[model samples]
Target: MQLDDLRQNWETFGAENPMWAIYTGRGRIEWDEGEFFATGDTEISEVMAVLERHGAPSGAARALDFGCGLGRLSQALAAHYETVDGVDISEPMIEGAKALARQPTGVDESRLRYHLNTKADLSIFEDESFDLVFSLITLQHMRPEFSRSYIAEFCRLVRPGGVVFFQLPTHRTTALKRLRGAAGRTMRKVRRSLLGGEPVMEMYGTPRKDVEALLTTGGLRVLDVLPDELAGPSWQSFRYLAIRPDSGD
Candidate 1:
C-alpha cells in the first residue's frame, strides 16, 4: 500500500478511537485518561527491565519513540532518559499525545515532546542523534519496505553504543486461513470505500534475516531477537535489540 493509504487508515483510527488505536486490535477499553496513562507507565517499565536483563545497565540521555501513539510511552520513557521525543504519522495522535504530555503545575514537561512525522524515512533527524531508539507494536502495521527503511533510520539515529529496540511480525498465515484473511481484507476495503467508517488497518510481516541484514547495513550490531506474544503466537511477533559499537559513555 502507498504511504498515504497507511497514513489515512491511522489518521482515521486516531480521529475515531485514539485510545483503542494506540493499543490496537484489542476490544474496547473502558476509556479513561487515568487508566490510559497508567498503561504507558507499565509498558515503559517492562521495556526498561528487558533492556537491563539484556546487559544494558545505564539509561539513555536522549531517546526516540518511533510511531509512539498519544505520548503514552514517551511519558514513561522520560524517566529513563533526560528527554524523550515521540513521533507519529497522524496529526490527531500527535495532538492527543501533546495534550497528555503536559505535566502538572510546577512540573516540567520538557523531558517529553511529541512530533508529527510524515516522511517514510526519518530524514528529519541527524545521524547519531538519539541515545536510544525504540518502537513496539508499530512497525508491523507498515509494509516491509517502509519497516526496513525505518530500521536503517533507527540505527542511523542512535549514537555509538546506543540501543535500537523494535518489534515486528515474523510470520504469516497459510492454507485456508490465508484465504479467509485475503477475503476479509477485500471486504474491509470495500466497506471503507462504501461506508466511510474507520479504515481497515492492515498488518504486514517481515523476515528475521532481512531485519538483521538491515541493521548490519545501518551500522548496528545485532544483539538478540526476543520472541513476543503481543500479537499472539499465531502472528509470531518478535523484538530486535541492536547496539552501535563503542565504549559506553
Candidate 2:
C-alpha cells in the first residue's frame, strides 16, 4: 500500500476501535482500562527478561516503540527506561495515546511521549538516540518495502551496544496459502477502489534471510531468531533479536 493509504487506513482504525485494532483478541467490545495496560506490562516484562539474558541494551536510558498503538508498549517500557517515545502513522492513535497517558492511572507524561510519523523511515530522531528500538505486531500491517526501510532505520536509531527487536512473519507455509494471500490482496484492492468503505487490515512479511541481511547491512549483529506464533498458525513468523557493537562508544 502507498504511504497515504496506510496512514488513512490506520486513522480509520484508530478512530473506530483503537483497542481492538491494536489487539483484535479484545474483540470489538469496550476494553477494560486496567486489563489492556496489564497485557502491555506482561509483554514488556517478557521482552526485557529475554534481552537481559542476551546482555543486550547496554543502557536503560531511552526506548522507541514503533507503531505504538495508544502507547501500550511505550508506557510499559517507561518502567524500565528513563524515557520512552511512542510513534505511530495515525494521528488518532497518537492523540489517543496522549490522552491515555494523561489519565490519573496512566503513565507519567514526563516519562512517556507519543509522535505521529507517516514517513517510511524514522529520520526525525538523531542517530543512536535510543537504547532500545522495539516493535511487535506493527510491521506486518504495511508493505515490505516500508517494513524493510523501517528495519534499516531501527539499526540507525538504536545506540551502539543497544538492541533492536521486532517480530514479522517469514512467509505462508504452503503454495496454496500464498496464492490465497495474493488473491485476498487483489480482492481488498478491488473493494477499496470500488466500494470505498472501511479500510481492511492487511498483512505482510519478509523472508528470514532478507531480514538478517538487512540488519547486517545496517551494522547490527544478529543475536538470535526465535520462532513466534504472533502471526498465527498459518503463517511462519519469527522474532528477531540483534544488537549493535559498542565500537568504543
Candidate 1: the clashing residue pairs are none
lDDT of model 1 at residue 199? 74
**Candidate 1 root-mean-square deviation in Å:** 2.4
lDDT per residue, candidate 1, 1-249, as tens digits?
Answer: 678888888888888888987775556555777777777788788888888886653454888999988877777788788888889999888887877666451114677777888899888889998888999878988878899889988988998878899889877656575576568878877887888756767777888899999999988888888888766445777889999988653
lDDT for model 1, on a 0 to 1 scale? 0.81
Candidate 2 achieves a global lDDT of 0.89
Kindly give the number of clashing pairs for every candidate. 0, 0
Q: Put down candidate 2 lDDT per residue, 1-249, tens digits, no spaces.
A: 898998999999999988988887444477887788888999889898889899875344899999998988888888888889999999999999999988776878988888899888898899999889999999888899999999999999988888899999999888999999999999999989998866878888899999999999999999999998778667899999998889974
Which of the numbered candidates is closest to the native, going by highest lDDT? 2
lDDT of each: 0.81, 0.89
Off by over 4 Å in 2: 25-28, 58-60
